[model samples]
Target: MKNNDMLKNILVWVVVATILMTVFNHFSTQGQSATSRLDYSDFIDQVHQGQVSQVIIEGQTIRGVYGSGQSFTTYNPGDPGLMGDLLDNRVKITAKPPEQQSVLMQIFISWFPMLLLIGVWIFFMRSMGGGVGGKGGPMSFGKSKARMMTEDQNKVTLDDVAGADEAKQEVGEIVDFLKDPTKYQNLGGSIPRGVLMVGPPGTGKTLLAKAIAGEAKVPFFTISGSDFVEMFVGVGASRVRDMFEQAKAHAPCIIFIDEIDAVGRSRGSGMGGGNDEREQTLNQMLVEMDGFEGNEGIIVIAATNRADVLDPALLRPGRFDRQVTVGLPDIRGREQILKVHMRKVPLAEDVRPSYIARGTPGFSGADLANLVNEAALFAARENDKLVTQKHFEKAKDKILMGVERKSMVMKESERRMTAYHEAGHAIVGYLVPEHDPVYKVSIMPRGRALGVTMYLPEEDSYSYSKRKLESQLSSLYGGRLAEEIIYGEDAVTTGASNDIERATAIARNMVTKWGLSDNLGPLLYEEEDRGGFMGSSRNANVSGEVSKKIDEEIRNLIDRNYERARQILVDNHDKLEIMTECLMKYETIDKYQVDRIMAGEEPGAPKDWIEPDDSIPPAPEVKSSLEEASEKPKEDLIEKDMSNDEVKEPGEPKLH
Candidate 1:
C-alpha cells in the first residue's frame, strides 16, 4: 500500500516538474525575445541622446543596455572615450584607450549570474526527477515506490474465511511445510515455495493466506503486484527483491500478493495498455520464486482470478507449485455459510438455513453473509424479535432485485400493466419446464425494478445449454408482453426500460455468444457475459452489418418468445387472474401461494408446500478431507431443538 502511495507521490512530482519547466521555459523565452529584439544596433544614437537607459560601446559600434539608471559612457558618441570609460568617470579618452572592455565582456558580465542560476535550477530539477541529465547520475523514472505491508498489519486468519473448505485445506499443507521443513524433507518431498489462489473476486483468496500466516504464527507481508512496477526499468526488479527479502527475513512466513494478474500477466500480449515495466516485474517475480536465494522458508502466495492471463513461468512446477481453485458453494455449503453468518444475528425459528440455502443457489460465502445482514436489517425495520424466513425472502429479493422503497407510487393504468406484466412472467415461469419455479411475483417497487418475479433455481448450474439460454430469453420478455397484451398499443409504462435491455441482450447473446441461433450456427462468436453493467456490449466483436443482422435476429427471437409467453398466459387466463388478484390484495406472496394458483390446487392441497417439520441443517459437502463427517456418532443436528429464543412468532421480537 505504501508502494502505491509512493508511486502516486512520484507521479505528482513528475507532473509538477513538467508543468513548472514548461511555464518557466515559456516566460524565459519571451524575456529573451524581448531583450534581443534588434541586432547590436545603431541604438547608440538614442543612448547618446540620453533617452536610452544604458549603452555599451565596442570597436566604434554601440548597443543599448536596457535597464534602470544610465549604464553607459556619459561621453559624446564622437568623444572616443577611454575604454573602461576611465574606471574613474572624470577621465576623458585620449584616442580610445588601448584594449577597452569589449562588448563580449559586457554581455557576459550582465547575464552570467542568471546563467549560473539556470544551471543550478536545471541540476536540482534533474535531482528531483530524472530526465535527460540524469541517466545514471542519481535520478531514475518509474520506481517501485509502494510501501510494503509488514507482518503486524496482516490481521486476517483462516478462521475469518467461512467457506472455501477445499481451498483452505490445500493452503494448509503449505503452512505445514513452512512450519516444519524437515517433515516434508523426511517424506522425500521438496516444499513448494509459492502457492497460487485463483478465484472470482471476493472469494477470500488473500484472507486465506493471512490465515496461513496466523496459523504458522509467522509474519505476513502483503503487497499488490502492481506495486512492483514503475516508469523506471530496474526499479521493479529492485522492489521484487525487496519484497522477497523481507519475507525471507521473517522466514517461516507467508507473503501474499493480491491481484497478481496486474504484474504477472502474459508477456507480449499487449492487451489493455502495454509496457516492458510489468514484464520486468513479472520476470523478477519468477526468479525470486525459484532463484539461488533458496526461499525455502518464505512461501509466496498470490491471488488472481484471471489465472489464464498469467505468465507460464510464474506457475511452473517449482514456482507456484500448488494452484487452488475456489468455487461457489453447494446447497449444503451455502447452508453452513448462512449458519455461520446467522450466529452473529438474532434469528427466529422461521429463519431456516435449509430454506435460504435452497433459495441462494449461486451464492458465495460473501454473498450469504450479506444476505444474513440484509435480513437482519429487514427484521429490525419491522420491529420483530428475531429475523424470520420471510425477512430472508425479502432480503434475498433485495439482494437479487435491490432494496424496497416503501414510498413507491404507481398510476392505475401503470399498476394494471405491471400486474399483468408480472402475471405474464409467473404464468410462463411455471409453464416452461426448463426454467426455475416462480417463488413470488409482485408489481411492488424495488431498486431499479418496477416489478420482479422471484425464482429459486433448483440447483447450481455451472454451464448453460442453448435450450436454457432460449428459455431465459423467453422468460425475460414475459413482463413486456403482459404489458403490451393488456394495453394494446398504449402500455402504461412502469419503467421496464432496464428489463427490455436485459431481454434484448439475452436474445442477442443467444445468437452471438452462445451460438444458439439456427442462422448464425453453433459457435460462440462473442465472449461470454461474465459481468459488466452497461449490457453485454463490452466485448462485442462484429461489423455493422453483422450487428444489424444480430439485432434483427434478436428482435425476431424476442418477438417469437413474447408470443410464446402471451399464449401461455392466455391459455392460463384463470390462473393469471387469480395470481394477479392475490398480488393486488396482498402486494406480495411466497412460492407456496404461486404454486396454488398455477397448479389449480387448494392452498393446503398436497401438504408438501409447507415447511417440513423434520428438516434439519444438513452437513456441508466439501471435497476436503477435513470437511468429512466424524466417524464417531455424528453430533446432533443444530436446527432440531429450538429454544424460545431461536423461534420468533409473527409479531413479537424476543428481547436479547
Candidate 2:
C-alpha cells in the first residue's frame, strides 16, 4: 500500500514535470524561432518595399531577417503577386524546399510529451493494480485492457498446470497448429478459429489457457469479457476491433477471453430493454471473429463457467469451433494436482498425496492449490519445519467446514443441546443401510453450525439409488427428531432450520424434478426447457392441481423419512443418550468413537489423529462471517450447494 502511494506521488510529479517542461519549451523556443510576429499585410509590405533582406519559407509560414538585424514571422497571403513584387524589389528570396512534414508527425510532435506522460501514468496505475480503465478518466474509455504476453516471456508452461491433462492436450493442438500450420493445412484441414473452455469455477480453465499460450511460441492476448463492455456507447466494439487488428498484426496468435459469459450472454435477454450497448458489443465481436473477413491464423480461446448462458451465436461452430469440458479433477487428476502444489511446500514423511487425494473427491485444481497453501500455513503456525498429514487434515477441514471457533463461548446447557443434536445425526447415519458411514461428529463448534456430524463415502458414487436417497433423507431429519425427543417440541431450537431446509429441497427435487415418487411416474413435473442449459428452471409449467399434487408428494416424502428417523431413534433411545453423554465429555469425537460407544465398548483414542504439540502455540483461528450465526451456527451455503452429489445438509462432512 505504501509502495502504491509512493508510485502514485511519483506519477503525479512526472506528469506535472512534463507539463511544465512542455510549457517552458514552448515559451523558450519562441524567441529563437522568430524575434517578432508581423501581420501578413505588414510582412508583404516589408517584402515589397525591399526592407526585408531575405525570406525563409516553411510551409505557409514565412520568416524574414531585416537589414536592421530584426526577424519577423507571418503567414503567406497566397498571392502570386507578392513573389513577383519581391523579385521586382531586388529582395533576396531564400525559399527552402517545402519541408515534407507529415501532418501525423506534426501532431505527434506537438502532443508527444503529453502522450508520454499519460503512458507513464498508465504504466504506474497498472503497476498499482488500478489499471487504465474508467478510473483513468474519460479519454481512456476506448482503450483495450487486454494483457499481452510472448511465449518466451511468460513463465507459465504446460508443466506448471496439473490435473487437466486432457484439456492440455486438446489446447496443445492449437500450439502445434501455430508452430507448423502446413502439417494439417496440406492435408486439406483448417485449424479451428476458436476454442471455448467450459467448466465450473476453480477448475483451471484459465490456467490451461495460460499454459497453451506459454507452449504456443506465439504472441498471446488475454482479456476478461467484462473488460470489453463500457458505459460509453461503441467502446466495446471499438476495443474488439482494436484487439482483432492487433491479433492480425501478430498472426498465428491466441486471444483468450476469460468469463466470456459476461459479455456473450444471450442477446435481448438482459434485464434492461433490448438493443443495449452490451448487445452491440457482442454483435461486433461475432462479426470480427468470423465475419466477411476471416480471422485466419488467429485462434480465439474463451472460458466461462456459465456457457449455458452465453449467446448461441458465440458458441456456433464457425466462431467457437470447439468446446472443451474442463470438469472437476478426478482422484488421479487430484493426486497429480496435489503433487504439483506439494512441490512448493516442505512435506513431512507422513504427508501422503494419494491419501489427501482420496479424501478430496470433488476438488478442483485451484482447491488443491489452496489446500497445499493452507497446509503450509498450518505448519508455519505450529512452528514446524515440515507440513504433516495432520496439518493437511486440519487445512481440509478448514476449507470445507471452516476454521474451528475455539474462542466462541458456549454455556453448559447450550453445549449439551448441541451434543444431543449432533449425536442424533450420527446414530441414524450409522444404523441406516446404504447411507455413507459416519466419519466424524463434534459438539464443539466449527463454521456456523453449533455442532456437526460428517459422513464419508467409501467410494465415489456417480448415481444415487432411491434407497440411498431415502436413507439420506432419514439421516438428515435425525438431528431434529433427537431434539424433539430430548427437549420436547416446545424447546427445539432453530439450529435445525438449515438441515430441514436442505432436506426439504432434496425431497422437493425428487418429486418435482427427479420423478422419484411413484405418483409422479417417469415424467418431470416441473418446467424443464432443453434451452435452459445447466438445468436452470425458467418457470413452473404445472397447473394448480398438478402443483398441489407435487406439494403433497414432497410433504409425504419428508413425513415418511421423518417417521423413519424417529423410529430409528426410538429403537436406540438408550444408545442415543449414551452417545450424547460421550459427546458432552469429548466435545469432539470421530465415527470410530461413536461406533465404539454404540457397540457398548469403551470409546478409544480418535482414529488416526495426531496429538497436537503442546510446546508450540497454535495458529490464531479466523472466523468466517458466512458461518457466524447470531445465536446458532450459519452454514457455508456455497459448499453445501457444490457438494450436492452427497448430503446437502450443512454438518460435519461439510467441514471435511
Candidate 3:
C-alpha cells in the first residue's frame, strides 16, 4: 500500500514538471533570433534599394534577411502596391497566411494556473492521508483513533504488574474467556460485555488491561476517552461506532479506554447542564456495549478515577458487568511493587524493599517506580556503584518533604524563631498521647516553609479516632502557640497562618462532619458536594439556630485545644530551648535527638549519618554570621507559612 502511494506521488510530480516545462517553452523569448526592428518607411526604402534580399510576410507583419546576412522585422502599412514593389525590386517575396490558435489550446493556456493549483492541493491532501472523503482523513473525521497491537507485540504480562492482586484476579477471568470462550459457553455462562477499572491516577489500571491482552494472547486496542469527542456534534458518536466495528472484526480482542471520565460524566450534571458532544459520545458508547447488536467476544475495559460521576446507564449489568477497584497499595502490595521496579537497579545489601514500602504507606505503583528511579539517579550523581539505603532515604525525603533550599539565606533572629516554631510542633506532638510519633525536625528552609516538623504513623489506619483528631488539632496550633509564648502577643508574626487555618478546619470537621462534638449528638451537619451538578442540598435544610450552635461548638473545640497546646509549651519551655539550640547547630534533627531533648539531655549526633565522600567536589561554604551581617542578604526571606505542615486524612502520612 505504501509503495503504491509513493508511486502515485512520483507520477504527480512528473506530470506537474512536464506541464511547467511546456508552458515555459511556449512563451519564452530565448527561441527568437537576434533581429533589429525596422520602421515601416525604412522597410519600404530598404526594399526599394534592394537592401532586403529576401522577405516573408504574414498579414501586416514582415520578416526578411538582408544581402549582408542581417535579419530584421517590421509591420507593413496596408499598401496595395507593396507586393508589386517587392516583386519589381526582385525582393524575393514569400507570403503566408496569418497565424491562428485553436480555442481549446487558448482556454488551456488561460486556465493553466488554476488547474496547477488544484493539482497541488490534491497531491498535498493525498500525502497527508486527508484527501477528500478518504479514510483516516479530515473528511473522514469519524474514524477511530484507537491504536491496535497484535498478540505478539505487547510484552507486558500479569506477572509484571503488582500492588493490585484483587484487581488482577478479577481481570484473570477476562483473560480466560478471551483465550477460550467455549469453556464458559459449555457451562451455560456468558462473559461480561464490559469491565470498569476505577482507581486514583497512577494505580496501574491501564497496565492491568495490557497484561490481560498479553496473557490472553489476543489483539489489543487502546484509546483515550477524549479522543472520541470533538467540536462537531456527531463526530464522537461516529468514532464510537467505528471503534466497535474494528473490535468486531478482530473478535475476542480487548478494547481499553483510559480516563473515561472525560466522556462518561453523568448526563445533565455539568456546570450548565451537560456537553452535547460528550453526551452523544457517551450515548453511542452505551449502545455499542449492550445494544441489540451483540458484540460477542469483544471485551470493553475502561479506567477512570472519578467513577462516581459516570452515568447510571453506562454502569448497568448488561454494559459494565464488573467494577474493579485498584486503590493505593498497602504495605505488602507496596513492597511487591517496589521489588518489581527494583529488579532493574543494582542495590546494596542495606536496601530493603519492605522497609521502604513501610515508610511509603500511600504510594501508588507509578510513585514507587519513580522513587526507585530517583534513588538510582541520586546514587549515579554521587558516583556510587550501587544504590544504597542512604540514596533511597534522600529520594524519599525529596518526595515527601520538598528539596532542601540550602541557597536560601536566613537572618539570625529569623533562624532562631523558625527553630522555636518547629520545636513547638515537635514538643506538642510528642506530649500528645494519641498523635503520631515525631520523625524529624529542621530549621533549614525546604519548599515554602521556613522550617518543618515531620510525623510518621506507626501503621496505616483507615479511620481517625476522636482522641487522635483532638491531638492533631492541638499539634496544629502548637506552632502558633509557641510563637506567641516566646515573642509575646504583639511580637508574634503571621507565620502561623496555615496552622490556624488547618486547626480551625480540623475543629470544624470534628463538630460538623465527624460529629465528635458532644453538642452535635452524632448528627451529620456538613453538606458535601458529591459529584453533583447542583451544589449540596443538605446545607439549605439546616436552620439558623443549628448553624449558630455548630459554629459555637467548632470555636469551643479550637479554644480547648489551643489552651492545651499552650500549657504544654509553657511547662516544657526548657526542653523547647534545648531542641531549638540543637536545630540551630545541626540545622536538622531526627526522632532520637528529639527524644533526648524531651528527656532533658543534650541531643547527640545522628548514628546512621553518612558523611560526604572526600573524592566528590563540595559545594561552596556558607559565610559565618559575622560575614553575613557585614553584607546585605542576597535573597529575601521566604514567608514563614506553615502550608507545608501536611495534616493528611487517615490513609495518608501525617507529615507536619
Candidate 4:
C-alpha cells in the first residue's frame, strides 16, 4: 500500500513538472525581441530630442529603434510630458503591434490542455490499480469488495455477543467443522456449504457470523450485499466469481454477507426486465455456492431480515444448506444482554439486570445496549454518580414511547380526555384473563400520543390460544369504546384512530388468517406468501365472491369483539372512573397503585420509592401530542400457539 501511494505521488509531480515547464517556456521569449536596456534619464532625453526613430508601446514596456538601427527597451511610466514630446516630435512613431507567437509555442499552448487531461486520466487509472501498469483498468471492476481479515486479527467471539444463544449454537457447529473437518468426515458426513441466518433487524446476525470466524481461527471476509452489483452489466457476476475464488484460496475461511436480500431477492419480479444487474448477480452467487469449482473448505454465512423473498434456487439444499432463526431476545436472553452492556456502566445498589430484563420483554440485543447507554446519559444529565433503577426505567420508557415532550401545552378538556382514554385501557387490560399485565399507565405526552399504557408479559409467549387472542382484541378496543361512550360519537376526537386501526387488523387476521371465525372454518383467505411493507407479492387465488365473504366475516369478528369490549367497560364503570381519577392526580402510576385503586383502597407508597434530595430540583413537565393508550403490538395477528406451517404470516398494518 505504501509503494502504491509513493507511485501516485511521483505521477502527480510529473504532471505538475510538465505544466510548469510549458508555462516557463512561454514567458522566457517575451523579452528576447529587445537587444539592449536603456537608462530612464537617457531614454527621456532621447525621447525629448526626438532621436528615437520608431517608438512602440507593448503593455508596461516601451521599445523603440533609433536612426542608427539600434533597438532599446525601457519601463513605460505614464508621463503625459513624454507622450506630448513624442507627439510633438512626430519621428515616424507608432505603437508596437501585438507580438505574434512562434509556431512551436502556439502548438504547445493548444495541446497543453489535452496533455494535462491525459495525465490526470493516467494518474487516476494508476491509483485505481494500486500502482502504475497494474491490472486495474475496466477489468478490475470485477474484483470483490470484501474486506479480508485473518482469524488472529478478529477479536469477536461468542462471548462478545449476547441474546442470540440459539443462533450461536447453530453456527458454532460450522466453526468446529472448519477447525477439524476430519471429525465430521470420519463419520461419513459432509459439512453444509452455506448457512443462512434469518431474523429481524438488530438481532445480532452479523455478530454471530463474526463469532464463528473467531472460533474457527480462519480467515474472515466481510461484504455487504449491495457491494456485489454495479451500474454496468456483468459486473456483479464477475465479483461473485472473484469472491469465491479468493475464498477457495484461503481454505477454511468464512465469508459473511449482510442484508443479503438486496441481491438474493427473487428474479423476474422486478419492474425492470429480467436481465437486470441484480438478477445476474443472484444467478452467479447460486452457481458459486455449489458449482463444480470444489470449494472444500469455504463456508458461506449470510444474514437477512427478509428471508421470505429469497429465491428458491439460492436457498436449496446444496446452496444454503442450513437455516437458523435469530429472533427477539426472551427474558433470560435479555438479562444476559443487559449484563453484557452493564459492564461499563456504574450502577447503584438498587439496579438489577433481572428487573430491567423483566420490564423489557421483547427488546432486541441492540435495543438493550441502547437502553444501557441511555441510562448512563440520564445519570450524566442529573450529575449522578451512578445509574439507578429509576434511570433504567426512564430509559426503557424513552426507548418504547419516546422522549417525554413536557413543554407542550394541553387544554383542560384534552387532558381529561387523555386521562379517560388511558383509564379505559387500564381497566380492560386488568379485567381481561390471559392478557399481559399493564406495567404502567400515564397521561404524559410522549412521541405521537397524549397518553400511554405499557404492558409487560411475565414470560415470552410463543403461541396464543383463541381465548387469549379474543381478549387481546377486546383490550385493543377499550380506548376507542370509552371515547364513543363518554364523549358521544359526534364529540369524539381522532385520538382513537390508531386504536381502531390495530383492532381492525387483529380482527381481520383472526378471520382470514387464524380461521377463528366459524364461517371461514380454518382457511387462509389471504395470500400466505406475502412480503413486507417494502414490497408486495402476487395476489392470492380466490374468487371474487369468496373475497367478499372474507371481508364480511372480518367485520363480524370486529363487531363481536367491539361489543365485548364495550360490555366489559360498562360492567366496570366505577373502576374506570376511579383509575381515571388516580391518573389525573398522579399523571403516572404503576401496576401496584392500579391494583390498590381497583381494590377500593388508598394505597401507601412502595418501599423502594425514594424522595428526591432537597438540593436537587425536579424536571419540568412538557405537554405533547396525543399518545395511544396501548403499546404498539409487534405482530398484527395473535398466533402464539400456532406452528410456522399452520399459521399464515400477516403483513404489518398501521402501527398504533
CA RMSD (A), model 1:
19.1
| Candidate 1 lDDT by residue in tens digits, 377-433 | 888999998888888977888888777776986654455556777887778877875
Tell me the spans in candidate 4 whose CA falls farther than 4 Å from its real position: 1-139, 185-188, 270-274, 528-552, 603-656
lDDT of 4 by residue, 240-273 (tens): 9988888888988999999999999998887767
RMSD of model 3, in Å?
A: 9.0
User: What is the TM-score of each predicted model, taking all chains together?
Assistant: 0.64, 0.74, 0.78, 0.74
User: How many clashes show up in model 1?
Assistant: 13
Each candidate's lDDT (Cα)? 0.69, 0.82, 0.86, 0.82
Write model 2 residue lDDT over 43-127, tens digit each, in one string.
7777776788877777677788898978888888687887787788777777777658689978977887788788777766775
lDDT of 4 at 424: 83
Better of 1 and 2 by TM-score: 2
Cα lDDT tens digits, model 3, 393-468, are: 8898888888899999886778877888899999999999889999889887889988899898877778999999
Backbone clash numbers for all candidates listed: 13, 5, 0, 14
Candidate 2 whole-model C-alpha lDDT, 0 to 1: 0.82
